[model samples]
Target: MVPSDGTAGRPLRESIRDKLRERIIEGTYGPGDRIVERDVAADFGVSRLPVREALRMLDTEGFVEMLATRGVIVKKLSRRDVLELFDVREALEGLAFRRAAERLTKRDATHLGALRSKARKALEAADGPALHGFNEEFHDTVNRLARNDLLASILEPLEGRLHWIFRQNDRPDQLWREHEELLAAIVDRDGDRAADLAVAHVRVNRDRVLSHLFGDHPEGTAAAG
Candidate 1:
């Protein structure tokens, strides 16, 4: 039970929703965990109305499900669902990499390098949350460099889902290595190579996650038992 500070400028319900979402991302409320409205409201020192509204919004975002008997439960992604999401992410991110390669300047490359450095340090420290934040910053930088708002809009939700999946992953080293390679291709201004690397990078992550979820192998292992 984490109490909200009640200091944010947003509406009460929105703030509650954001807090719950953060908890979900931080694995405080993991997949299949029950989210009781009464518990959440009591935890946040709020009424059930706001809690219900927040849960409804989270449901629409695919973060939770409201079942007849289960009430509200945290959403869990199946292997097939994860693979399909990776397919979409791979396509969009590949395109983003191609465009970013064409538009990337020395300054942009330097900025991306800084992000990669931060991510690498986070990985070295074994800080999963920090690594996730830096990873988002890196991809967000690439998306912005692509200079296509529509593409960014389309990828935003998918990126959120990917973030959720990534939090469940245990291979920060592999992920950072892929990021390093992708950044290298982008810095070299090799659009084709960057695009290909981006696709392969996502596929590798997808496979690793699937192997963990459905197979006997440990998380982050490429082999499926």
Candidate 2:
């Protein structure tokens, strides 16, 4: 079965868009690669209209670019783009962890505990894709525990690109360890420690991504965040 995309009843356009999005995220369709509509249509066994609509959604979400002359292609992330995104994430995520630590309900903690267990099992099983999804869910669960609607709304727009970065992580064990540390702080109800750990997590991931993309460049040049 094709997995549910959480798109509220699996509208055909959303389903197609999500499949294309997953391909792009997992590097099956890479940066700057053209996604021919007819080819995607054939692959999905559908007509071109849904493919076009899905491309439009992906375009708006900053996943791919729609072009009149060249068709659709995956969007490439500039170094500056990645760095600035991490900057925003550092601020927002730090706050989310702090608030969540301070205000965690028993139910919220239970949900987080379940997610943590699942993520750890996925890590142990060497399930890369499952761990990638769990990475996003981890952050989003913390944000939800924060119980701030304004913050949730702000974080919503950046989630797709953030998920893209999470998909870029080649070191899930390290990522899992970092998340475990942060989760530990939250469970201990140490708001300040949780906030510090969150900032450190974002910074290290930022450096890792920069190093991967631009090759051992120093702090200020490529990572100007």
Candidate 3:
């Protein structure tokens, strides 16, 4: 029988890097937090070289910054950085929405509906993690249904940045409402409308993040609780 324990096969450096990357993405290490190689090596029962390899890998992925004098630190996104991330999201996702609408199939519609239902339940139950996962599924489904590999490839990285920023603020019910409306537009085969809605949806999120981070709202009442 193949050993199920992760200790037997791959090099320790790759294993450590994967584990550290997962933790960083899951918010285990918050912005500007210092990662001590010796400490992590002791905690994981590995040598410091593997831990150092993991930290360097994280730096390449934009999750950590290696300071000349301060070792490795988790990256913190500034207000401008958040906006730039959303801009990338809008461009790629807008293309996805347009193409998905242009060629949406019955199966695609069915899958989208199922995703919407799941997202609705997650929202009602106030399940933040489940809701975020569902939201990603919905968008990824649309991109796949679009039959555009290049667009999907571009979206993959931006999706991670979106989650990183969105998780910093509270989930808003309006987000689900907007998703439903966007899905409805796509289902109706209105490519132009769907494309517009897709861009607006991303813009609204960017606005929300900016508001949460910098106290700038777009002429609206306070978000309902």
Specify the highest-lDDT model's number.
Answer: 2
Give the 10-residue window scoring lowest on summed lDDT in candidate 3: 1-10
| lDDT string, candidate 2, 1-225, tens digits | 233332567777888888898888889999999999899888887777878988999999889987778878999988778888888998899899999999987888788899899998998899877888888888888888888999999998788788898877688778888999998888888999999999989988887877777664546545353
- Which regions of candidate 3 deviate over 4 angstroms? 1-19, 41-50, 217-225
Shift of residue 81 alpha carbon in model 2, Å: 1.4
Off by over 4 Å in 1: 1-9, 216-225
Please give the ranking of all candidate structures by TM-score, highest first, separated by commas.
Answer: 2, 1, 3
Task: Give per-residue CA lDDT, model 3, range 1-225, as digits (tens).
Answer: 111233568767767776776666668988899999888888887767778877887787677899999988989877667767777878777888888888988888888888888888888898877776666667767888789877777766565556676565556566677888889988998889989999988888877877786676765313321
Q: How high is the CA lDDT of each candidate model?
A: 0.80, 0.84, 0.75
- lDDT tens readout by residue for model 1, 1-225: 334444455667778887888888778998899999998888888889889998998998888999999999999876666767777888799999999998998889888877877887888788876877777667778889988889988987666677777766677666767788888988999999999999888877777777677663334433322
Residue 180 of model 1, lDDT score: 84
1 or 2, which is superior by TM-score?
2
